[model samples]
Target: MKTNSEKTIFEMSVPGRKGFRCAPSDVPAADLPEGLARGALPLPELSELDVVRHYTRLSRLNYSVDGGFYPLGSCTMKYNPKACEKAAAMTGLSALHPLQPIETVQGALLILHETQTILCELGGMAAGSLTPAAGAQAEFCGVKMIAAYLRDQGQTQRKVMLIPDSAHGTNPASSVMCGFACKPVKTNARGNVDLEDLARYCGDELAGIMITNPNTLGLFDENILDVTRMVHEAGGLVYGDGANMNALLGIVKPAALGIDVMHYNLHKTFSTPHGGGGPGAGAVCCVEKLADYLPGPVAAVIEEMTDEEPPVYGLVEPKKSIGMVRAFWGHFAIILRAYVYCMMVGKNGMREIGETATLNANYLMAALKDVYPLPYDRVCMHEFVLDAKWKDAPGIRAFDVAKRMMDYGLHPPTYYFPLIVHEALMIEPTETESKDVLDAFINVMRSIAEEAKTNPELLTNAPVETPFGRLDEVKAAKDLKVAV
Candidate 1:
């Protein structure tokens, strides 16, 4: 909801007003290309103080990790440490141009090279390519590599990719983009993949199977080894969507579990800042068997010298590369932040992160299982899902509970996701959040549940405390009234 004092810059504009007073030009006027330039720009006119105040107020209105408890489920909206930001902003690394001479930016090259090494070790892969722009792009890279590998092996007819019913929505899209028809497998009542259904889908045409470990349902597939083995018997590879890697760090290695290829959301799992339309980094890691087919220009050690002299790092293409995914190397600053985060928290710290995150999630699940309907009433990895369909109060929905949270000054969990569960409210209490914060969140949710039973009108007309109440969401979507 908007504060009454806030207005669009345009609305606050006054004619002849100026934020700056520029001196008169003494040199000759510059010529413009014919029809290439415009007359006066339509920027808002305001004093410097007015512009600053307006932006400051707008910033305050936003919900941030720094401001409150943001349990945005699979997104992993944890607090990003300021140390990583400072390290990423260092001029030695930040100012080094991507196209600069290799000899000039040895330190920058070392950072990229070492970061790749750390990620490969962490994900239990022989090599890694940190060039994919985001998680879905990383999935596309892995699937495309599988396609190229199959083509090279003369298996042109192998064009079906099996994805589980509870897999990320991007998995099927990535498969289709890589020229593979998607065959959706079912999720059993226990939340693991249905082995019979998976076996039914596997055949000579099976290109690969893309599975999200510790899947969107927040349950680790216990029979993952068997799932991979079945795919192998059918002559198909396996791709791991490592978006949920936060739950598996230091506990299990995907490669050891027979995952041939996978991608890591460095921004989510490695403590780099994400969300709010910011840039992201997704490092694609592949096992030794598929190392030669990775995306090109992976950070590599070009030369080895004496102990006194450090090893030289440079970009080198894989044996059967898929060419460049992005223009240059990956997002350097994002990679730098993730690298710093890894260094700050060594192997033990990484293990602690996974453990604490899992414990926090289980704690919330135990506290609220009675208040809400727990779809899979088992121990969750790092998140859990709850249903909003109360038996007594039929129409009380997930949206009402979510909106009601806002009235209590708390950001709501992700709602209506994974597509399998009805009215799903996915909550991920990251390790960074404290027990107190989790307790408050749980209490708020419990209170909302009680309100749903006693007074359904409060749930229907939720977020009454905010400046706006009960938005026509469908109409708002079709006719977006966006203000510049």
Candidate 2:
């Protein structure tokens, strides 16, 4: 609850009691622009405690994965080790500016270089670019590279990209963003990509196909080999959306199993703090053939035979590069965190992360299936999709279930996604969460099911304890604004 003495932003204003003091400017007052500042800025005035308390109260509203079991489907909100966070905050790397002299910031560069190398080996790609700031950006870069490669081969007619119905929505968004036509392929009842639909779309004009293995529904593509072969035979490249890489980190390599290029979301696969928005690192990896077209300036090592000092930064581009996607080699601090995460968990440990993630997800699926309807009943990967039909049948909806989760002091699973499933409740517990946490989460969900049957209103009129009740989503969507 808000304290009795608490003040809103407007209420906090005073005549003049600036908690944050500033020194006089070094520049002459007369040198300032005419209209820059004719009057004093109307800012908040409060004590240090007031400022701290106000912000701390605001921070409490956020339902973070670290705070509870957040099975947010494909987002993979795994626990980011505090040690990785500390390593990223190290003075040497975190304090360095991107524009600093190459020799002065070799440590940062070497970290990125080695991380790229490690990710390449882990994903079975020859080269990688740690430049795209997010997974979607990486997908955009990968798709653009596919377009560039096809355009160079005189296959300008090839402008359509094939994506599965079960693939992440970002697949089509990235495809269309690359200036190519987007074609959606259907998924089989078995929760795998419809290979027939993929073949039907395959042709000379098809640039590439993006597949998320252990896909959105949490089932692995049973015919992955045949699917890749079909795409390759059609003179097209294959790109894997590495969003589900958490499920394949050690079990399989997308590139080795016929994928040509892929993107790795550091925030998802690695131990980076997912800020729920920007500042996530998404590195793109590809084979040697595609290395020339990688976004630059990628980190490169230099030798110093002549003994004045060690050589400086190295950067090279091939014949048909996609150009710079972001300024100054992406988010170095986020990359540092991811690097620390990877190094902390070596090859064997990475495999364990994958294995445990898959095992936990499958276990959760089995535990909850009795109460919730499994859309695709099978052994899942690192996540599974559940249907809300039971809740929907008992006068309860997916939105009600999501809102009710808040009342139970639990975050809700991702709802209404993957498009193919109705009222999709995609859950991915991730390996970081323990079995006890999973059981507790399952119990809350199971309780909701029973409550929905007896006291349907309890679920429908849920989140009674939250600051905000059911949101008017349509109004919020139509009228875009956030409460102050």
Candidate 3:
């Protein structure tokens, strides 16, 4: 039933056409290594027109923040404002090389330094490192700092990181990457960490716990003060994952809640393009006690001619450092985008962002609760977790429901996550989206639910309108059919 539109790749491929030309191999040809080059390069070849049209079709298949209302939970796929892009494209910051001398790139450094200041104030921490290129990298940097701290204090046996079952997958993966065994803490009926279970794990051999505020399931940890008190009393540190910062932003500060360290995802919270950003900027902050172990090339204001000479590139040294996580500095352009977003949205605007985000989520929960089941019945922070167990009762899984959403011209909300709740659908309708857009999403979901009960087959084989049908996911992952 599918036609050229579906198989555009096939039409663009030509056997003997090359759009690019290079000088013929001029250097004397040496004996090649055994089995080095492939017998043929099976790249698709066509006139530029064909290639352009093919890729344009493929790009349309993707559902970006700019394309539609994306309620992807915890990921914060909210619209990255166009202003961020404009600011990042300025030649002074965007066009400069990372290796340019600090003196030469002082303008870029000042922007970076100002960003660090904002992160410190936002997280209520003593200092920050803009060197982490992504949230995962930031987490690794923070964990390594923890590792170095433990080694210095001669508590090398503190080799375990406690993660909540409702935590992001990166929490455990990052812990394992840092050479620590992971201990999973269970969630209570309310979706917060079970305090009794947590008490059982905090001891001499535990290094730290990775806590997500407005957790993956979109519920705040009401017991955070008690939790932080317990960890500090037990000689442990806490690492805050600020991936879901679109929720807390102005209403609360993580360090004020007793967190020692945390990383901010500028892409998620500050409207910086993520996938297209190439490399993101993560600002990691910590309490003064732990600041000495932070990763550096720390940026400080120093005297060039005097403390007055426009304070040039000033570097501070930590007594015990974890060394540098990245050479040169982090992505300057992306950080510039975050700085622009922050400055535009000052104190009250930031809090209003949080309030609107939370308000939108609550409205969405009300909009669809009749059709879907909510696992934890509570006031959600910036998102909410809905259960599909009721639909699964008749053999329809969350996976089926998700696929059906695509058929209705919407990107599906995250499904089967947080692990604590069976058949979880994590929906985070960020404040950027309006009531009308939210209604369209809810209506599509409601229609899918009705169809699920009356005709389950539609749910199984979905996205009928897209250029491609349901793919064998494992086959695509394990055995990608590349042309070459």
RMSD of each: 2.1, 3.0, 3.5
Evaluate model 3: give its TM-score. 0.91
Q: Alpha-carbon error at 191 in model 2, in Å?
A: 0.7
Per-residue alpha-carbon lDDT of model 3 for 1-484, expressed as tens digits?
6564656465657787766777999899898688997777656777677677777876786778898878788777888889888888887767898767667877777888898998888888898988888998899888888888788899889998999899988888888998999999888988888999999988998888999988888889988888888888888889999998888777788999988889999888988877644578787899887899888877777655465567776566566877888766777778889999999998778888888999999998988888888889889988898888663448788888888888877877888887887888999888899889988888888888888888889988886877568989899889998431
**Candidate with the greatest lDDT versus the true structure:** 1
Candidate 2, position 426, lDDT: 90
Name the runs in model 1 displaced over 4 angstroms. Answer: 1-4, 28-36, 467-484
**Model 2 stretches with alpha carbons more than 4 Å out:** 1-7, 12-34, 38-45, 304-313, 391-394, 477-484
Q: Please estimate how well model 1 matches the true structure, expressed as its whole-model Cα lDDT.
A: 0.89
- Top candidate, metric TM-score: 1
Our model 2 lands, by Cα RMSD against the true structure, at 3.0
lDDT of 2: 0.85
Name the 10 consecutive residues with the lowest summed lDDT in model 1: 1-10
Candidate 2: the clashing residue pairs are 158-205
Alpha carbon lDDT of each predicted model: 0.89, 0.85, 0.83
Lowest-lDDT window of 10 residues in candidate 2?
1-10
Q: How many residue pairs clash in each candidate?
A: 0, 1, 0
Candidate 2 structure quality by residue, lDDT tens digits, 199-296? 89888888888988878888889988888899899988999999889988877988877999999999989968885586898999998888889888
